[model samples]
Target: MSPTLLVMLIMMAVPVAMVFVYSTLSNVVMERDPEFVGIENYLTLFGDEIFRKALGQTAIFTVTSVTLHLLIGLGFAMMLNSGLLPRLAAALFRVIYILPWVFTASIVVILWQLLLNPNGVINYLLEAASLIDSKVEWFSNPSLALGTVIFINVWAGYPFIMISLLAGLQGIPGDLYEAAEIDGAGWRARFFNITIPQLFPILLAVAMLDFIWNLQQFPIIWLATGGGPLNATETIATFTYNLAFSKHEFAMASASGVVLFVVSAIVALFYVRHQKARD
Candidate 1:
């Protein structure tokens, strides 16, 4: 093989080999050792209330964040493409929105921690404007913590969706809109009939990407709440981390990881089929 081919093979083969070896060893250890019982890790996962709750929380967070991100990002992209805004203004807005995606996850989470804190700048400003009576404990409130994290994730991640949708919007020929205008179709009708149908593939691709990313997100939740406020914000990723590192249950953690991978794969396959149909 050529050097480039050799490098690509090594890059792909190492992880695949490692996963296969690890899975085989894990099963063997579970079968032979009393410390690691056969399939007990999976049994624990299903029977454990905390794990089940964490899975539910993760699903909620992923769906809500992806939905909001797509809606807001596509909305902004449409506004930018509408020609109502000057070119310079639209470019500037796009640049500003893209900044969030460029920042490290740690930076975004830390910044949000400050912004969401009870006595932080956000509450201070709101108080000054008489928008609220007192500061709210955002991360400490179990009811609001997950939603707050989802909001932060959406805000920081929507730029990717925006850029994708904007590219799709630009590819759409302007004559379609002009023809629609001449035919007396309103903005909503034109958008629903022309823009959305044409952008379905891009939207599906972006949604799948966002769903996977949001589903596996760990650092943001860790930094903001550490899956705290009564484990209300625990995700599968964070749960796996705690199981492997804190609980010293590597087998169980691996099981959870496998489950996560399977779920994500299924979702991606569905999106692929849907995209194929659209094409």
Candidate 2:
């Protein structure tokens, strides 16, 4: 095997095995000795209200962010593919759209922090448009923080989806669309019938992968809100970090990590089966 593949395999496997072992015992980082306590961490996790909230938040975050990624990405891809602009212009927009994605996640979070401040340009634009009478607290308000994180995630992630769908769109034979037009089909009919059907397989694959990524998204949400304002924006990834490093609940953190691994594995298994059926 290639060195790169060997490295990747080791990287993926070792941490999971270590974390699973740590979950069944108390290993407070390097601060203390390891204690082998069976399933005590799981019991603590089950009774922890914060963990429950984080789990629910993760589900909401993953589903909403992934859905928006698909819809907005599809919209941009279709717009670019609509023949409304020249190839050069479309290509330029693609480059511009992916600019946010080119930066490290921490940098992207910091940039958005600047933009989403109460007195920031986003609120200024809103006020100029008379959309609101006052500044909106993007990260400080508990009610709005989770949705704000999801919105930022969508902004950072949609370009990848857009480019992927664009590739799939360009792969479609023009004759199929031309034939549909010749049969007197409206654009809506063509999109619903031809475009959707042809893209369904790719759509499922992208959706599954995107869901997995969003489920464990860490830096963006953490840097933006630090799972703050009463842990409103907390997801599993942030929850694990806060537990392991911040609070020094290493055993519980390892259990949370193990749970994430199991949940992700289950989702990936389903995705693999669905993809196989498509083939």
Candidate 3:
């Protein structure tokens, strides 16, 4: 316990404390005599147009990704758990659906890059089907880059929710459904009254956790578009990365990182509270 606690403090607490302290100072990591600017960094961040844009885009990305992940995951989970399909077919589909989750972000991004390229299979199919006359630059077009990245994120993320929800769905007693059927409840009614109620706790927990994960997603976006196409897909994670490494504004980046931390912390508090209530 002592060794584990020591490792935790060294690995997590020290870095967090350093970032928080750096967020309050100016010229950190770039200058020997950094000034203590207090909250000036945060003030400047909020006033900066790029930061504001990144903040808003981050919100949109996180919300859209989480919502789609939940919806798609729920749909797939229900299908897999419905027992309508044969066991072998269900197992095969489960493997296919969960395959995306097994790939690393780098691999996922590269795969999408190839598929979404101007002369790629996607555009070729669309062109062949007469869906479009010109090649679509999925990641290079400002209007579509954000949505494209969101789609990639959804593609990669839904499996987590699907697997978890499937487990939760299976744990539900068959007797509950039998009782609902005995009462002459239809599919919608049974799903709404029994399935939803039974799965609400798991849903809440996963949704909040997924929100946090997607809110800080960086690698896929960075690798796919580099938050490019005129900054259309710039998220807080990428913005902070650019600030720290690209621009060498360590203090400002630290402030941005702290902001992200605060937001995630708030969500985490809600998650903890919900778990307490559920328990």
User: Mind giving the per-residue lDDT tens digits that candidate 2 earns over 16-81?
Assistant: 888898899876575567878999999999798988999999999999999999999999899888
Candidate numbers sorted by TM-score from highest down: 3, 2, 1
Q: For model 1, where is the 10-residue window of minimal lDDT?
A: 20-29
Per-residue lDDT of candidate 3, residues 1-279 (tens digit): 899999988999899999999999997989998999999999999999988999999999999999999999999999999989999999999999999999999999999999999999999999999999999999989999999999999999999999999999999999999999999999999999999999999999999999999999999999999998889999999999999999999999999999999999999999999999988
Cα lDDT of candidate 2 equals 0.90
Model 2 is weakest, by summed lDDT over 10 consecutive residues, at 26-35
What are the Cα lDDT values of the candidates?
Answer: 0.85, 0.90, 0.96
Q: Kindly report which residue pairs in candidate 3 clash with one another.
A: none
Candidate 3 at residue 182, lDDT? 97
Colliding residue pairs in candidate 2: none
Estimate TM-scores for all models. Answer: 0.89, 0.93, 0.98
For all predictions, the C-alpha RMSD in Å is 2.9, 1.9, 1.0
lDDT of 1 by residue, 99-168 (tens): 9999888999989888888989998998999998988888899998998988888888899999999999
Per model, state how many residue pairs clash. Answer: 0, 0, 0
- Spell out the clash pairs found in candidate 1: none
- Show the lowest summed lDDT stretch of 10 residues, model 3: 223-232
Which has the greatest lDDT? 3
